[model samples]
Target: MKNLIILLLFLFVGQQNIYAQKTIKIWVVRHAEKDVSNPKDKDPDLSPLGKERAEALAKYLKGEKIDSIFSTNYKRTRLTGYPTADKTGLTIQTYDPATHSELAKNLIKNAEGKRMLIIGHSNTVQEILVAFGAQKPVKELTEDDYDYIFELTIKGDKREVKVDRYGAEHHTKE
Candidate 1:
């Protein structure tokens, strides 16, 4: 019931911004689950469920008209966004994970009034969200967390965020 309300709110807002020239809409998501086969591997690809989650992400944003897609330079993050890029005919651009503030500034300045999708890591998403003007406290993403879609709408200095879910419901691994 909570997700349904959030989804409805997101859809309503999404509709309102489709043709607006002064609003910027950004959907920030953590990369889907990665392969844990090689636990020591610094970089890894998406696991089978991750791939399915990727597809679900794409399908969820099918008509959102994303103007750009951004991802960290890791296989897991790249693949998490690949399905959406492929479906939308947009290429995934890489950003330096360490420069979260810079990336937020660049996007606000250059990509104004456009919709974007950012696929980031658990540790990076919160920082990026803050840089884009999220004033309230946001929880850190845990290893077991992977289903949040941080919907952001920016107009000049004002930014509104809505946390919604996409793909299958993820339960925290206790």
Candidate 2:
């Protein structure tokens, strides 16, 4: 019984080592532009421009080591994250769009010290950024916007956010 208890303690500590709060980077973006031809379709596929944008994003982050990819259960979001997932050879994990807090916890739990790409919608991106306690993050994204990226570096209790743009810049008419 003493030997068994000692072995169990060793196993538990080994498992805990994998979950140490190591610094990590998380890139958040709204899904690439979606097909608007079928205006009535709730889940339209990615538009040609969107596909190109997704490829661009993958190329832009090619040098980084992506450990995970996440997206909502929607054609557009999945397709938007597909390029990165393919490049990283990582499967895209689907999460409920409304469960922002749970998603944040999942990222920290599964990807400690790793990097990830989270594909989200314009509105949901705001929620995700908020869940990370991002600083100076955008509150909302417009339909015409698809190039912004919210890059976050998390170290223990500190989260630093940086805003960047990928692919062609969206020109919102004044």
Candidate 3:
């Protein structure tokens, strides 16, 4: 019995080390609120509230060694990545929405062995999530909703992603 217990403890410690080494995390967030000052209706930069939220997000990600930053070819998404990128010294790569799938595929290919943060709009986030092989589909996420954060972990052929609602609880999807 003593030998058996020792063997099991050794195996548990070894497994923990392997799991720590192989784990990778990705954080996906919607761009912060936008300015509506331009009554003429053109895309504007982040509003004051948006700037505050962006700063909050930067603080939230301070310690993580973010490898790459990816965003859509839009001002909002670029602005969202700015504070974090400034802190981490990671350059932001712009992906065109017209070729969303292609951009997503290339991102996953290039991000192998590295952690990435992707900022996108409400409409585009779900599409990219699907491209990443995420099984659950968010049917209705609006611009006012800046709540859901998608956390994804990929190792070899296996993929796991969970949705974390900002005001609520995190749930793992099937």
Model 3, 4-119: lDDT tens digits are 99999999999997775355567788888788788675667888777776776777778978998888877877887899999998899887766767966776666666788888
Clash list (residue pairs), candidate 2: none
Model 1 residue runs over 4 Å out of place are 1-21, 172-174
Error of 1 at 159 (Å): 0.9
All candidates' TM-scores? 0.84, 0.83, 0.77
Better of 2 and 3 by TM-score: 2
- Identify the candidate with maximal lDDT: 1
Candidate 1, overall lDDT? 0.89
Best by TM-score: 1
List candidate 3 segments past 4 Å from native: 1-24, 165-174
Question: After best superposition, candidate 1 residue 7: deviation in angstroms?
Answer: 42
What are the per-residue Cα lDDT tens digits for candidate 2 across 104-155? 9877767777888898888888788778776548655788889998899998
What lDDT is reached at residue 100 by model 1?
A: 79
lDDT of 1 by residue, 67-134 (tens): 99999999999999999999999999999999978999998889877999999988888788898887
